[model samples]
Target: MLEHNDEIRRVKISVRPLVEYVYSSGDIESGFRSVAALHEGTRIHQQVQRMYQEGDLKEVTLKTEMLYADILYQIEGRCDGLILLEDGWMVDEIKSTSSDICFMEEGYPVHWAQAQIYAYIVAKEQGLSQMKIQLTYIQVVSGEVKKFVKSVTFSELESFVWGILASYNPFASLRLDHIRRRDDSIRSMPFPFDSYREGQRKLAGAVYQTVKEGQKLFVKAPTGIGKTVSTLFPSVKAIGEGLLQQLFYLTARTTTRTAAEHALGMMQSKGLHLQAVTLTAKEKICFQEKVSCKKEDCPFADGYYDRINVGIMDMLSNETLMDRTVIEHYARKHQLCPFEFSLDAAYAADAVICDYNYVFDPRVSLKRLFEERKKKTVLLVDEAHNLVDRGREIFSATLGKAEFLELQRGYKGKNNRIHETSRVVNQYFITLKKECGEIKRKLWKELPEELINKLDLFVQEAEQELQGIGHGDAESRQLLLNTYFAAQHMIRISKLYDERYVTYAEVVRNGVSIRMFCMDPSFLLAQAGKGFRSTIFFSATLSPLQYYRDMLGAGEDDYSLSVASPFHREQLDVRIEPLSTRYRDRESTKGSLVRLLSKMVRERQGNYLIFFPSYQYLQDVYDHFSAENSDLATIVQGTGMTEEEREAFLASFRSDNPDTLVGFAVLGGIFSEGIDLQGDRLNGVAVVGVGLPQLGMERDLMKDYFNHIGKNGYDYAYVYPGMNKVQQAGGRLIRSEHDTGILMLVDDRFLQRQYQELLPEEWKE
Candidate 1:
């Protein structure tokens, strides 16, 4: 047990005062508690203000801190409201409650503590001796309102706040001690790798420079350079140097997460006593086979905040690397919600390993981690090129009329409010269908603002009805909840909608739907890059660094580094067959492609991978080649390969006494990147076509849009994305210095100057 003092008080202060008490355990119950509460409150407040023209309410302030004893002892709490009292000094605390406020009496201790905290802050700030505090609780389910008001002297409020602070000080002191110890441990940690490779050293140097300059860096380093360790080693050093306090290793896929974990483990093995946690998606990490995230059903979720502190303290004291297995072990032991436990652990972690959504997606971004952009934190976006599409999907929203119609029918008799709200949204979709003239074709234009405004109005009504219901009607309640999220998503997307987005309507089985599809995500990508302390976007094939930098939101002021592949030029046999595999020429070239691919594999007596633009193309060429070369073993990518199937495919590529093995895989699929086939496990790669995307309205529209922006529209929209797949396919050939392989590009376009210019320096003749 430690004694708490004024120094502990200074360090223990909540960065987000209003949310300090909410606890990380609350996140497991249902997403982010503080953000959810704030969102719900804002929604209700907006509705109430629209209905009633009372004196307008305004934000008082946030994270306001007041010194009680010099700079050591302080009182801080975010003021949610500072009501303009026509006469008296009134401090308002707006609360969004799922439970019926009428069920609670006037003197609930939780309510009192909340109001008292606000009153103390207002009284201190306004130089008032006494203040009237109002606790405005709006039922999130019912839209019913309740108010609890009381007047207390500044001295009394001070005493009440001091009591809460006294209890919190013990926890604060413990956290500070832990942080100091962790930082001290990190300071003495050694570089995990015995020797850094040339490429690794270059990448590490770039990361350090980026941090030193406090600017973004886009690095293009080939695979096998130990990208994760190269980036992590430098980032951790930055932490030791007090340049950064936290590092976020964000990845696009699960397989990549394992690589990050492996890298961290290497560092840990090298005596780095850092606290790092890898966050698994809530759906995957949930203890329950299927997660509902309701309090009654989940013992871990019920009263999570009540036990979270103990769980957090216990884990912090006993563990260093809180990986999923460690987290699950601790969570089960302490009866803590594992999903929420991971999030809580992340806040205290020196580094976090997780998916891109944890940082980039608005719906799922770790709100607590990014509260202050200027905070000493660094984001290492892994496989960053994936973000171009992933970001668009995250920021865009789609609502089908079918789901609303089903909800309307489901809730018609039992839940009138919910059913009515569902009907309103359904009607809006119906109106949208009418506006689209019953066409099921893709549209290439901007979404109508008026339509979005109407949807906004519908969102308000649905939110109010959902709030009125609270948590009673399970099925109908869920429908409303889904609608609420959809509406919120639309609201976010509407803000970013511009010429880059194409408005398209589709009709499927008598149902008409409209979408504000993102034709190109470059502009939106640039928007997300803003306000970060720094970002490093690096990949093996950011070959034409200028194209990636331009599309990846790299500013002119942002630094760029291109590290060449360390492997000797002699190791890779790069060949370009001037064969036409263009969409128009596919029929004529199909036989030639199979013959060319067969010859490449026969010449190289080892496992080979043939990458096609689509499953159809892959199957077509695979069938033709398999028919001709029946002696060679072939594995083809199916609609969805199970774990066993994927294993069998890789296992076929034996390293010892390797035979001719050809695996047909689609470009830009899972097999393209992250998989390691070192030495003789894989030898040659034959990439069919330029790997351009299928001719779709979206791709065409993207081409036109970029052409309008003073760029080569075809390359921007089609050629580059296609070439990315081509490059990724080619990258599979080389795994290590000992690995010698051939890369055959089976497309005439690769021989053209426009496409040829984009080839990596090492590949150029």
Candidate 2:
């Protein structure tokens, strides 16, 4: 037994975390986790466990304490199984692999280290001096097993434990020092701003209390409340109080991530010594033209793990603000992959600023996060209104027929197994398309298990070929890899298929595309956020709290808050044009909308934005408005604008501009909510419609699916979401107490009872 003391900290670590840190080294593989391989691994583990004798114990929990220098390292984990031998016991660790087992000579040293550690614990517990540890590798596709055994004396195991501790101590000590300083700085830190807005402290206090109590919070504070700072400050304070270990500042837009970074900077100015890292998308930050992670393809990925620790130590020691530029600099200097380096630093960071995908997307989430770690973490979701649709899109999966058909042709004579699997999957879609007849579309309430079965089999066969791929078949290899990803995703999602999901198949010009559309992502969202200490969902537009609460999976005990606007309602001059901007009425209303936009700008010579529901509407309105009012200078938001273009669009709304600038952009677009244009920079905003999503198969499917349950399908699928965007677009008008602007609601639907009730209290007033 080891005693706990203040002078020496106790590092309660696990064997897996220790070995994974010191041993696991490889190139950054660009692929999704194989669902088939994961399931097969579990099955193989069970098969091995079943073969254990009566005296053998499976999943034996093990723990041991050792003193290194002055720090007590307490490591605990469960071994796969413990087998009783005639003279000594053998510690067995089972593994499954897609690649051929014959290629593995003695297997990975990491596997031996893992089994050796478990053997040490069992020997220490039984007071034995000798132990035998075994590594069992079961080939996933072939079911062939390979075994390697090693005998070790107790002194050798003890030496091994000390060696492991020596390697981990530097990182552990650095973290210990940082936490001490971080807690001290947080304790003495004052609010970064000279004074808080009227509702700011209230929101901050609510966030702290929610995190302390380990409960989710849904907050609706009006714009200009300094929401980012308000939420982040409390979460940081919670970290200092030992109520939380990590904070994930999740954002829906790149612009909002900047807001979070700015907030952290402000806090740092107030003597906060916390480590925060911002994760940029791989495509945007990668130095290479294409995102190939092969060591040969990219120099940064070569020997990455060998240099990552040094790079992380240097980065954490010197910088508190590890944004993209800073991260990239260190990565380049140390020859480490920037994207992987950022993720590595994030695990050690006190806070991480990244897209919601890093935390919520099943396809791209950081899988290394365990439940124990999550229990000590809090999620501060920024611009949370965008997450509803984002959540749905993240959970859905689509597979096209063309990819499989091409695979069938590409591997016809090359590999019979691959060719046959591709043919079978392609034939299913062909029959599916014909079954739909003239409609050319079909919907199924349940997942087609028959299709899932074929995909599972195909995935198992595809993995075998993809293991030792060559450049000669680059085109075919890429196609198979892409198709494998698609199949695995569908197979994974099929397990979660419920009433909230619908399988839809549509015949397109190229081929048939099938999608497992997630209608309401609330359940999935809830599951993703389950083990976290707390999740603070704060936004300027979380109106009709009941609707959002239901859609976001808020529980009965989960807190809800609606903070009144600190700015006076009188500052916002709201008006209802009562004009039809519906799809059917858009042709006749186009001239009216353009005229209204022109007249609204002509009234006051300041910057203004007119938001339409779609890009086409914005273009049509812009063409007519520009042709009729040549004197008015206007900028139109184009589809797929580059980063510089987006910045230019926002820059066009300058406070120093002497003339009127009417900017036309789509509702729920890049500029609507995230951009900040304080004071006279932005004068007014006109929302063209209720912001209903265009009627489509997905939307209609969602409506029907929700209706089948006990909820109002139309409101869930359309009205509530549309109204939320309307509020987000309108939120641009009033940004500060000193700011005053006009908000014109162009559509007559705004006057309807359903839409009227959904508007925020301040907006309605």
Candidate 3:
């Protein structure tokens, strides 16, 4: 909700969330929800609306403001129909559900409350003495309808709405009070740091200007220039100035999340009273060893809605920075799902620290952000370079024949519809496999419409089967649910397919796999980022600023700012070994690479990190380095390392270490970006390659597509992405002005004009 006035403190909210919050109850339904689009319900609504007589109005807008507890709430909503009765007008609210209409009986109380609220607004606005309210429920599939009607005087409607507002008063009061305090603090707060570093004020000014003008800003700020605080400080000030309501600090890695949190905490220590929530991934935060949201298996998920409001109120009232630890603590105290609890709290927060998926990914995005709220919210995307690949991943979808084949076999006698649909989908894949016999790969510019239709039927049947399955049949239910989600993703992506998408089929021994690969996600990214007040994309390695701006969907009028490194050239000892670390030359050059790494570590009696393009290369070189040194302290980053392991790896590079320590990690792995090891903590960084991604069909397809579009095909496909990893890896060194570290680039390609031009000015002689 946005505060519309300064003298009286007016809060604006729509009717749906306002009523649902007060009426929402029952267990958390974390099962397979029907993925039917909302537009289906709208179509049904229009179908019902078309049946009304001539004088009745459809989709009528109603709004009213009520004074409660010294705060004015502007409530507004669109009634489905306003029918002219013989005596007066009746507010008709239409709802569509997938369930049987026969079970609706008198209809839900929330539905009645919503209709009555609209009636209250209408009656109050038009000076009507009384109004009739109707709740109309229709079955989505069968088109069966049920209607429940009630007549209430204006006084009764007024009393009911007052009660609703009373129930919502506690939450509203907290928000109003917090906003007052947060704004006051922001007005009086000084910079968290004693002084801004070089280029910090310039970046911060650019961010503030962008938010002020409601435009996007792309920033190429260096690592040590305090990008996190620089961006966040201005957004916070914007919230205070009433230019924005909230901001989302979006990042791709856990370490960057920590940086944002730290920045917020620094401000909080300086008297800021903003409420910020950090959303953690469900799999990581789930209390269960295995994430099963069934009520019988997880107490935290049972009756979650009943407890969630109270829990959120308590948490928000007491805590300001509700990160994972604080959220988990409150969740346990209230026996609520931590993931859902965090999301609930996030909706009311002044700042949300979360992943890019929450705003960009269609499947998992926070759908509750209404259009009005978005016009006042800003997105500060940290490590914006990572969104290029992350965008590709979120927009793409893949389905294999194995799951459908298993379903066809397993559910043969259990459910014939599931079996038949799965069989049809499986047959489609089999035919595709036969067509790609020798080539083993097939590509198409158009979507696989035939396969998509089959998958849709399969998904519908799987959803019904899942809903009907007993709790004891968890195994079969799990399989059906998994395949249902896959099919849902495929169907969803199919709707987004355009000239930028490519449908590809691959055949292997066991089965055939098909993918709807998103070749250019810029358009989709722009669509997702629309409606927000502004977006700030900042990173240390957003080199080739034009490329990032283009790939990130920057508008022609959007501003781009590049800040110079705060650290001097003398602080970085950069050396190029001019060695070939390409795929084919690895074996022949392994010994030389090992010798160079050993010599660097031997000369520098401090902590060092050597980054390779792949784990295979890391392991191979580590084998030789270990055999040759035999006395060095080394820690190698493993595949899928746990949180504790990653923390321990960073903790190993102690400032007071007795001997030299070297950590071998992959270039784009967790160790590459967002980790800070200042001064003696990290003395040197050795990058073994130019960080080109392995050659593959996807790369080739991307190359061919970009070439066809007249861009530099090779650079767009491989060099840009690869060099980004190298830059991120090298950025780990010289984190602050006081830090001076050696950086070695072992790839021969670094001397080339194309690659040398990509290097940061401070990294070159």
Please provide, for model 1 over 134-206, each residue's C-alpha lDDT reduced to its tens digit, 9 standing for 90 to 100: 7777776557888878789999988887676665555555655665665566678777867778778778988
How would you order the candidates by lDDT, starting with the best?
3, 2, 1
Q: Which stretches of candidate 2 lie over 4 Å from their true place?
A: 1-5, 30-37
Better of 2 and 3 by lDDT: 3
Candidate models: Cα lDDT each: 0.74, 0.87, 0.90
- Expressed as tens digits, the lDDT of each residue in 1-765 for candidate 3 is 746346787778899999999998988775667765443677888899989998999998888999997889999998899999888899999987766556556878888889999999989988999999888887665678889988999999999999999999888988888888889999898889999999999998999999999999999988889999999999999999989999999999999999999999999999899999999999999998989888888999989989999999899889999999999999999999999899999999999999999999988899999999999999999999999999999999999999888888888887888889999999999999988879898888998999988887787666556656433256767888888888898898888999889988998776799999998899899999999999999999897998888789999999999899988899889999988998899999999999999999898699999999999989999999999999999999999999999999999999999999999999899999989998899999999999988999888888888888888889988999999999999999998889988899998899999999999988888
Better of 1 and 3 by TM-score: 3
As for candidate 2, its clashing pairs are none
TM-score of each: 0.88, 0.98, 0.97
